[model samples]
Target chain A: MIVDSNLSFLQYCSNDELKTLCDTLTHDNKGEVRLSEQLTDNDVYLRCYPDNMKGMWQEIAAELQRFGGNTFANIFRGGVGASYESILRDVCKKMKVRIPSCSTVEEIEIALLTKYCEETIGSMDIDLLHELSVEIGIKPQSYNKQIVAAAILVALRRGGGKVLAPVIYYIGSNISRILIGRGVYLATAGVLGRAAAALAGPIGWALTAGWLAFDIASPAYRVTVPAVIQVACMRLKHNSHFLTAQCV
Target chain B: MHPADAKAILALKKIPGFNYLVRKYMEYGGESLYRGQNLANHVKVYEDNFPALYRVFKETVTALGIDEPELYVYNDPYINAYTYGETRTFIAISSGAVETLSPDELKGVLAHECGHIVCHHTFYNTLLYSLVELADSFKGIPYMLFGPLVLALQYWSRRSELSADRCATSIVGAQAYQKVLAKLASGMKSFKPNGKELLNQAYEYHDIIEGSLWGKIQQNCQVAFQSHPQLCERAYEVDRWSKSCRYRQSRIRVC
Candidate 1:
């Protein structure tokens, strides 16, 4: 099928614009069918179950008893479809509705998405994964230098490896304080070259782009210019030499 | 390789945080980021003030068989404009500048911007800015060396302005340009003076352009370290070139 627009399945759709989209992508076009954007195997059992972690864990435990499925790898290893990561705490807390202290990353994920989801999970979406990760309080921005530096100090106390880049300890603090906005943040001008080197791919793009938008050097003509100029200069020299000889 | 494809590849290798999106984009081909809702959602507010200008921009594109160019605004004071090169081009004019000039002047500025697209300048800039973001990333380099490189980029940037100026002049001929310049001379030059005397001042501007040796020196003095040639200089340059032996023979129809 021809790709009609930039948005994937929901690119053009609203939360309620389901009627407008064709059901060719659906395994069952009937209104009875639904797909969770999570990973699930038992589509039928998935439909009736609550989506919390407790419900998920109950489903997982029941499935284990039913099919002898009893390994951490067996459940968590399958797919990245479940929004289990987003509501991990909610899932565990929801499981608390049944039993207490049943909490772990793997259990929370598998319980919610693998067994608890009401419909088969749709394809994996990285954005949803990131959002889920955020929900679990795994803030990515806090992973910059100072946090690493503090970790290093703790590491040094426990006798870890030598500090590879100690200067960054002082610099990252300053960078965190100042570096704002999306453009190049001069966290550490000292390591800027290194950062720039790291950023070579993007910078190279900017250079090439800046060059093209700003510099219009025709390679075809670059090759031709010197060749043509050299020939023309040679003829001019020859004529000048002849004129000098005639004058003499 | 085509510049567009080549830059896309380069952008993938570079632009660190954007790699994930860029790679996914390559795997599943990305399409133009336009939708019909773009008009009523964004374009409607612009219609409130300049209703006629807004109508012409929206309806004329479909009527004239040209795709509607995407528009964006960024706040900057110094006067500058550019066009984006993509599946179709998009153009934007800053409000800081709009507040500075008139309707005719804005149209002339946009026509000059359109000239860049017509001349295919944006394709190169898209590549160049991508590289600039790359070069800009390399912060540890000695300023002694890197400083000159950036300055040179900027220096060349100033030269490219001259090239676009030619395109601007061509699209909006000397007649329209003369009116625009007069309006600018009155508004921009903080002075209160004679009326007919200023129109005759074009002769003085012309003299500064194609003048005696002293006049040439004065003209150079006026434009030194200036990225754009002054309005008088632009008028003079166009006037001189159009009157020259070679420009008359050009088939592109510039007067």
Candidate 2:
């Protein structure tokens, strides 16, 4: 059985399972198998199939998975060797999302997130829920009376802040400006949040507030805020011992 | 070299001052001028930087029994691949073409450019480039006097592309070759196209060309000065040749 190490398969497989599969592949091929590096989320996974053994891929996957676990179940997630389009379709179906016909990968992701939110928002805290709704740039309380509102925020984040703003603006016409403004606001908040966490003191909070005020005052300053905050946070982190010693 | 190249050469020979112009350009610093510009603008393809693509190029040259031409990749958004220089022929593929095409499709493009080298299009192409440079310098004198020469050269240039298309088809099958044309026609963004549908459209274009005199005239006028044939026409030619006995006999199993 030929062992394939596609993304969906690698995502589920434990390190031990991956090692075993790699060992089996190497042994079967007498060390011809090449494992370049561990697959990362950002990496585009190209399907690997053994040469001249085309039709027997299913049997190979089954046999390999038997040695491993449901790590191989992902190979059968759509079928023996599913196309990315099919996998996206399957995910959409399970989420009960109706994506526009022939939507790109980014659009499908947003749709799935929107559906998930609609199905499960009743249990969320009111203030946290309000923050989430603002983060996604939608009046979750008014527009989406169903479960759709919950998923939108997470979906927007996943789809990318820049991309989701236009999408949200398009969907919620009356609140378009608010949605775009909120997207920018949320993105800045998230960046500042990171800077604050990294700096870790009253001084960090003061610096974050200063940076936020400066960012709000000038659009040009907003571009540099993230970089400036990152550098400032790094410098503070590096000088933590010196500051602590001075205080003592 | 392919059979169609011989026909193109015959057509080129019939054009007045074609050989004289080519010889004159060769005598001038035409080769150095282009080589110097290319050296400045492009990065040479080598095993270290582009191992897999270099392997494909080397294998293709060996299979075709042509001297290995220097290959370079230039950063340009325009999806184009072309060959230049007379004594030292070089093939240059745009970064856009490399990024946009699949490995097999890229190989087909490289093979097509190499085909120009194999079929001796580089010499005439160099001559044409020299004439254009001269026209730029003199500002209308050369163009006015050698207008017909330019037209004839352009005509042969289009025919040369068809010959190169056949050469590419022989190396990487017709499907891959047709995809190069299809991708060039349709930019690398937006909807993915059906290959069979693209091929059928090319065939359908042939009917359009045959059915109306105006369509034929319009198509001819449109590509009158262009170096390459329209994508659909090239696609149709490649598809037709793939099924031909000549292609079957000459086909190399690279994949």
Candidate 3:
């Protein structure tokens, strides 16, 4: 498989578009499959490839035209049948979901698709989401999963490169504090904490401000952490659409 | 060795003429020149002279089961320590470090430097030192010629410190190692730094760098020439490792 240098193009694509692209690439024509020369796992490619790639080419072309020339180069460069299971697994891993052992590919796909809606999203309280919405400068009209996901999507997209870092940082700090519990907090009670406390009311604000203050080292975590959060938010948005459609 | 350190070293070795460049530097009075400068400028610690400091060095070497390297103390206000020279290596601690760190923390520092010796890190580390000096001196041809090489070395150098930190933890326990790191983080400026808080600060920095693409890019460019990982990063790594099964196993074996 030819790995594209510009994997960022994948970031621009939606879940449906990615599925469409995957189907087009892996579609078997007259039983002559284009096996990836690089990957040794023939069985993975065989079982995983979408069966109707020959029929999907026109649709993919139309989609690529919409994305323009840069995405055109990216799509062709990424022209190999990647396992849909693997893609789902990557997203699940980024979302920090611990899948049960010995699960089948179908099970994994179901797990990823329903993961946010069935588990964490259902469990999340409206007040927490409301607070998060307010923190990101969004005032939600109703306290629902749909509104929360929309608010997060807007904030994440609007913040983009300039304000995205602090926004993510703030969300992460609050989430961690929630997960771990504030009373159990033993790390941030010193001079730095005191100084940051002087800045504002919410500790997440202080955490974000403190994070922005320092210059740091280059670790792969720099990419992974934000990517994980972004993936979670994007998945939340996708799942909320499903919820809305189900209600309708 | 840390996985990152091993990976970086492999990548660094793949660079053309890198091995040859390191060999040439050693062959052409590079190590000797630095050794001479050390002997001339720094005060050597021994039984006859700085017996108290020498004891800590001896204890660390004994714990790690390596022959004692020369120990030197330089009159620098910066709380710093470094290990250099391959054939006859020496660990140099700044006077500020001697004053700042406690006796146990000082042992942790020594163990870290000795960790480099035990892991056969001195050879490549000496090359890193020389390249840094060369970068400072020549600045044009050498910098352009070995820019990527130096960056790779620095990358390896940062990971190498983590391995050293683990070694130090094995000898002195994780708490002492973390405290030593926190003390180092203070740079002799503050009274006493809370290790947990300092680690939280590191986590915050980690979040910031991870949070934004621009932040990561800015850091990558800035740290391309740095020989060490940031103090908070070191603290974070050691602390995280301390909770690992490997750290527990090493502690048991060392004990």
Candidate 4:
């Protein structure tokens, strides 16, 4: 029985029960979960988890709730880690919502949680949401936060739960490492996106005229800097969402 | 040094009249012209002026066990740095680079320039720099004549950049060096980066380069005239070297 120290509800289970629960978690309701053979030890989840995990995590969380583990059961379906309060604070900050300094952590958490759920996308910071939307391949017709958020949610459903890993990564959210570890989503994004990403644009060339404007000292950088910068953009684009499969 | 870079240097050596061209370029005071031009145009950094940047440059040079070269900052909005001169080598950074890079990233840039110096690349690099200027200025007849030489120099120059990146990575640690690379790729406004993400991207790029014939042709044609390797390839090379026995063994002894 491999117990994850992070999930506190494991403490409620007796030794025998823990063994059974562990078996249940690993096996799902089916037989042994067939993980991708290519998955390293770091990624212990099922390979078919894009569909399976969503349904299965809910079932397990419900079972745990019946076992009197309310806290673990109420954990966000987004698979955010134990540092939910900090991540919520980050989401609030990025969304530019003010948190009262006097408010307790729990109060602030609940307030922000309500705000995150109840507020219209229009009330959210347009720039942050737009930036995040573009990053995850959501192209809503309008900049309304709700519309954009809805688009992202729809994309998440269609693409699988891991589709928003980049957005979470960008916003500094403590999304569980388990989500990031499974990289097949981007790997399967297709050759065209990969090709466009691998061959970065001439960002360096556009900056060159400004770089060489002075023209007084023909520093050897006239040879290297813009070219190096060009290469850097290539690396950056190759790594960023540009290469990821269009989840939307 | 990367095997590709070593091979490129050998190919450049094999080019006809390559040595003669470098000799003639050097004999005509090609290096001296830049010293005067830079002294007049760029701000020289010493103990007093831009002391912080000078300290980083000095420290980087010392770490690499190389002679201290004069440091200069040229006014420019684009982030860039380069090593120039022969008998008395010099390294120059753009004002934009100073404004943008963090202290450690600046160290990585300086270390890269210092690496070029340590590797005895400045003299030939100066000739290539001059040839590019000459070709740009006289695009008709002289450009036609210098085409082969320029292509070969560019080829070697790209590989040399990989070697220099390795030197910087070894000195500043791969993480900071990668940040510098990422910053150079993007601009200051979008400076945030995860090193592993960048490496993963680089790996994807390498896959394209290896797996697709069209990708190889496209990349070769794109970089044919440029004086640096594709950034993703450089990042990929640097990341791999950072994890290699050579880098590990060196660090162990240094520690």
The candidate that wins on DockQ is: 3
Note the B-chain TM-score for every model: 0.50, 0.89, 0.93, 0.93
What is residue A238's positional error in candidate 1, in angstroms? Answer: 28
Residue B184, model 3: lDDT of 73
Ranking, TM-score, top scorer first: 3, 4, 2, 1
Reference-based TM-score of each model: 0.32, 0.48, 0.51, 0.50
lDDT of 3 by residue, A150-242 (tens): 666555545543234334334534223321222122223355444434432344443334333211232222222322332333334444455
Candidate closest to the true structure, highest TM-score: 3
TM-score of chain A of 3: 0.26
Clashing pairs in 4: A121-A145, A121-A146, A231-B231
User: Which digits, one per residue and each the tens of the lDDT, describe model 3 over residues B1-255?
Assistant: 554665566666677887897778778887788788889999989888888888888888887888888888999987788887778888999999888778888999899998888767887998878777877787656778877677778888988998898799889987778788877766664556555756888889888899999999987777777888888788887777776556677788788
Q: What are the Cα lDDT values of the candidates?
A: 0.37, 0.56, 0.59, 0.57
Candidates sorted by lDDT, descending order? 3, 4, 2, 1
All-Cα superposition RMSD per candidate: 31.7, 26.1, 21.9, 25.9
Error of 4 at A157 (Å): 82
Query: Which of candidates 1 and 4 reaches a greater lDDT?
Result: 4
Runs in model 2 deviating more than 4 A are A1-248, B1-5, B133-142, B189-192, B252-255
User: After TM-score superposition, what is the CA distance of residue A140 in candidate 2 from its true location, in Å?
Assistant: 99
Off by over 4 Å in 3: A1-248, B139-141
Candidates 2 and 4 compared by lDDT, better number? 4
TM-score of 4: 0.50
lDDT of 2 by residue, A1-248 (tens): 23333222333323333333323322211121212112110011112212112223334333333322233564565323333344445545543568787886545654543442333233334543454566555565454433444455455556553434333233222121222223333335466535434433332232233333333333222222222222222222223435567999
